[model samples]
Target: MLLLDLLLMLLIAYGFGFLYYGLYRNLSARVHGRFGPSLAQSFSDSIKLFVKEESTTFGWMFYLGPVIMASGAVLNVLFIPFLNQGESLQGLSSYGNLIVVLYLMVLGPLGNALGVGSSGNPFGVMGVTRGLTRLLALELPFYLAAIGVMIDAGSADFGIIMQAQSTQSNMFAHPLLFAAAFISFLGFMGKSPFDVVGAPQEVYSGPATEFSGKFLALLMSQSAMFSFAKLLLMVNLFWGGADHLGELVAKTFVLFVAATFIGSVYARFSTVQSVEFLIRIPTLLGIVGLALL
Candidate 1:
């Protein structure tokens, strides 16, 4: 029964994740005054990559990279409760807390970095370096906000946090913290102004430069699932977890649309610029939010 629930969760993550990705492209194209591909284009692309004739690898480590990344993503989905108060949708969330989920989030990227480094691709290494550098600053405000949430609720448990917000969602009770987190969340979604890690013109696809065929397909699949996990995290933390699947879709879609529109308007930031901006602005908001708490 537990395994069946887990499978259902993965299916939801993959389905909605790709749906949002395709919507992101379509929305961005509209902003640029051009028609975009259909909403299923992302799924089609993933299938095409999977069926490609060949893929390159740099030995066992490289081969394991995408697998490890996918594992981390899957673990994240499995550990996070889909509903605020329900046995049906909750997976292994009872066995973990926010801190555990936070640590799991970084596992995939770190594993991918190792594989990219071993692939002997200078561009991939550079991309990984930029990603790591950006992450240091990216995580600060988010961590601070998360800490404030946990402290306020007096527990690291998601259910506790959600219960504390029964009268008022965190987005309202703690606007400053939400502001700080939302800004950082924009970066987490790889929006413009914080998307230097994979700037095609600059890094030739960044950490993904050497990946092809099935490896690339696996990365895409993991990315879709990871993206949903991040969205679910924010919804649970701030918007309040949903009681039903429809409510969940509505909240996450609103958040996703906000990130997409913001990303479309801004230009890409240099690595140094992004780090400096994050350190100064969102970090300051987070500190102030914590102090207010």
Candidate 2:
């Protein structure tokens, strides 16, 4: 049953991710006054990539990296809630909390960085450097928002956090943190401004440029997982966990739209500029939120 529940959550998150891939394309197209591909475009792309020829630069480690990344993403999905009190596979809520989730969230990216580094591509290495650079700044607001939630809830377990918000959402209590977090989330989503790592104009898809075939397919799927996990994290942090599946989807869609708009409205920032922006603004807000708490 636990295994089945875990699989179900993975499937659900993947479905959302698949939908998001199409949603992004369609929305981007609409903004440009051009009709876009159907919402299944992402699924189509994944299918095409799956049957393509596999290429490898590094040996055993390259093969291992995607697998590890996907595994970590799957673990992350199981740890978060979709339908409140609905189902949790690992029963890890007892030991798990914001701190654990935060650590787990980085695991997939770390694995991807390792894989990309092993491939011996200068561009991929540059992407990893940009990713880490941006991460250093972007993490502060998220950390501040998370700590505020922890303090308000008096516990780090997400379920308890949700319960605490049943009476009053954290967004009200920590508006500064929310603003900081929401802004930082833009960076986290790798949209404009903070998309330095994968900026096609500059880095040529960055770290994943060298990936092909099955490995690429796995990476794509993991991207969807990462997207879903991020939405879940945001919802849990600000609004608390959704009370129903419909509510969950609604919240996720709202976040997706917000991320897309931010991506569209802002021009891409250079790595240094992005780091500077995160540091001076969101970082300071986070510090204030923590101090206020």
Candidate 3:
């Protein structure tokens, strides 16, 4: 039964991850005053990539990159509970806490970086450097906000935190912290302003330059799953965990839409600008919020 639950969790993560990404592209298109591809387009693209063979191979390291990335995403999905309830719906939520989920979120990107580094492509190397540079700045504010929440609950456990929100969700209890985390979340999602990592222009000279065919496909699928895991983390932390599957969808969709809309309107920042903005704004807010806590 536990194994079945775990498999269901992975299926949901992968399925909804692709669906949400397709929604993002659609939302981005509408905001830009243009029509986008169908909602299934993301899945279709993944299938196409799966069938296409890579023309060049950079050895075992490159092959292991996407697998490592996907593994992190899977762990994240398994760690976070889908609904705030008994041990049944919770996957491995009993065994882990918010801290573990946060760390796993970082693992995927770092894993991808290792693979990119092994490629010997200067562009991929540069992209990884820029991404890791942003990542370092990314964690401070988020970690600060997370610490505040854990302190408030007097425990690092997700169950305890969610239960505390039975009266008032963290969004209201700690708006500043949520705001700080939300900003970091946007950057984490590779959204605009902070999306300096692999924007189309950046990718032309960035990480995706080296990967092709199945490698690229694996990256895309893992990215989608990782993104949904981030959404799940935010929902669990800020909104309080949902009561049912329907409630879960609505909460995550609203958060997803808010981020997508914000991403669409904002211009992509340069690497330096993104790093500075994250440090100055979100980090400062997190500091103030933590101080209050």
lDDT of 1 by residue, 82-191 (tens): 99987877989999999999999888889889888889899999999999888889899999999999998999998999888888999999899999999989988889
> What TM-score, computed on C-alpha atoms, does each candidate reach?
0.98, 0.95, 0.97
Show where candidate 2 strays beyond 4 Å: 86-95
Tens digit per residue, CA lDDT, model 3, 172-283: 9999999999999999998887887776675664777788888888889988988888999999999998998889999999999999989878888888988899999999
* Alpha carbon deviation, residue 163, candidate 1 (Å): 0.9
lDDT of 2: 0.83
Top-TM-score structure, candidate number: 1
RMSD of each: 0.8, 1.6, 1.1
How much is the lDDT of residue 239 in candidate 2?
84
Question: Candidate 1: where are CA atoms >4 Å away?
Answer: none
Taking all chains together, the TM-score of candidate 3 against the true structure is: 0.97
* Predicted candidate 2 versus true structure: per-residue lDDT over 113-143, tens digit per residue: 8888888889998998889888878887788
